[model samples]
Target: MLGIKVELIDKIGMHSSDTAMIFLEDVKVPASHIIGEEGMGFTYQMLQFQEERLWAGAAAVVPFYKIIRDTAEYCGQRKAFGQPVLSNQSVYFRLAELATEVELLRSLLHKATAQYCMGHNVTKMASMVKLKAGRLAREIPDACLQYWGGMGFTSDVLVSRFYRDFRILSIGGGADEVMLSIIAKEMNILPSKKK
Candidate 1:
């Protein structure tokens, strides 16, 4: 090995996964391992971030859909006050609203993906998608979890796990605030730098 050491950082939510803290103290990297121009590392990483954020946004869509769908199904089967929980207008309406949000996010992701494939810069759109996805990832699951009642609070339920795990979406990547800042800059709404 090239003298690389990694330690696992115990995370609260993604307990089933590994988050590593890699240490490369005094580690020498050969020039052959360098990517692109020597002074362009930051530029390359920023370019790659466009793709990574898009992927993170797209990846969140499916699980959000499934959580909503499964919660709806559960509501249909679970009885409350001698009627299916899904029979209530509030329940179904909220589910419908959440579904709409998911669809909107999916459409944006698709549009960004298409534009990116065509050699267009998708920084603004991708940031929008990531921001929306992060917000919905928190919103949809929490709403669905409420329908599950006490069961949703328990660790055994998948929705509960998702509730915990989805929190990272907003904080990870570039964060919701960071995404907003990027979008603002792209839209020329940010104040010009003062010299």
Candidate 2:
């Protein structure tokens, strides 16, 4: 499922632009194109982030599952002291835990999307999903690659590639701290006192 690139001339996937605006842009294009109902661009952009973030989370799910599988295969084949590396429970279960985390993140993303589509306010949900996905993207492949020892450091292994590639999820979708701040603002958790 991963590494399959589609040939579509769509800017949404290219520059992380939202599909909603792309459609809107197509219908109404002018030399001076300022979008939304005057000062509502912030709200619209937040909504767009929800969709883009959910798509990002969905894109990561399958590749993460495959990481566990590939790691298991590597452990099974790799030997140390004439015993298969997978004979160690820690190696296998750590990855199982990572897979569980990946699934949990996916569940949150799906739930957020469903709620948003049902006309519920999903700002908090979106922030949560983006935050978790960012943290997971950093930790999962990093931890999985560590399981491979020296091979994880080499370009020959897919784990190495995953390690190199998955780092962008946090910074690209929105930095992890940015999501936290947004969620806090949504929940009125940010400190404020009347002057």
Candidate 3:
């Protein structure tokens, strides 16, 4: 820990998670602390990314279910034109679609997890799950936020908080575009590199 300084980066969204900027000044490590081979740090970190992506996908699951449930409950109570907002066909239909997307994502996460547990390589499926999760995390919150209308724009509401927090799902842990590229490469569709 000597000569290592850590500072929090203040930015919009996911404030509590606290992205840190580490400054290493004349840092030295004992040979005993080296992980795997001396030159394989990048490879080791790359290997660890699979698990991080899966976690990002899995972490969004329960929160999504909760958000969907809370949004539905709010819609059921908030009225417009003398009837519950949820009573409107479009609102109900969109909620149903969002909920179904969440379920589909959950299934993919489970399948990837099972394969990972069985020691099978799940790169493709995990990337797919992460990609879908990132997209749904953005879409579901935005849609639900609209139902809350003015209240959704306020920082106090869960929908708004999620709208901010979940934005990182698509941006962090490899990003949606990076995930797509990974999937394409895994599928053997990427063009061969020229030497």
Measured against the true structure, the TM-scores of the candidates, in listed sequence, are 0.92, 0.75, 0.92
Encode model 1's per-residue lDDT on 24-62: one tens digit a residue: 878887999987788998888888878988998888999
lDDT of candidate 1 at residue 97, scale 0 to 100: 96
lDDT of each residue in 1-195, candidate 3, tens digit only: 789999989878888777899999999889999878999988998898879889988999998988888989999999999999999999989989998999999999999999999999999998998899899989989999999989999988888888888998887878898999889999889888899
109 Cα displacement, candidate 3 (Å):
0.8
- Lowest summed lDDT over 10 consecutive residues: which window, candidate 3? 10-19
Winner on TM-score (2 vs 3)? 3
Give the count of colliding residue pairs in each prediction: 0, 0, 0
RMSD of each: 1.7, 8.0, 1.7
Q: Which candidate order results from sorting by lDDT in descending order?
A: 1, 3, 2
Assess each prediction's global lDDT (C-alpha) against the native.
0.91, 0.78, 0.90
lDDT of 2 by residue, 81-189 (tens): 8998988888878988898998898889889889988988887887787778778877888888877889898879877776766777787758888888888999889
* True-structure lDDT of candidate 3: 0.90
Task: Please give the lDDT score for candidate 1.
Answer: 0.91
Candidate 1, superposed: residue stretches over 4 Å from native: 1-3
lDDT, model 1, position 80 = 89
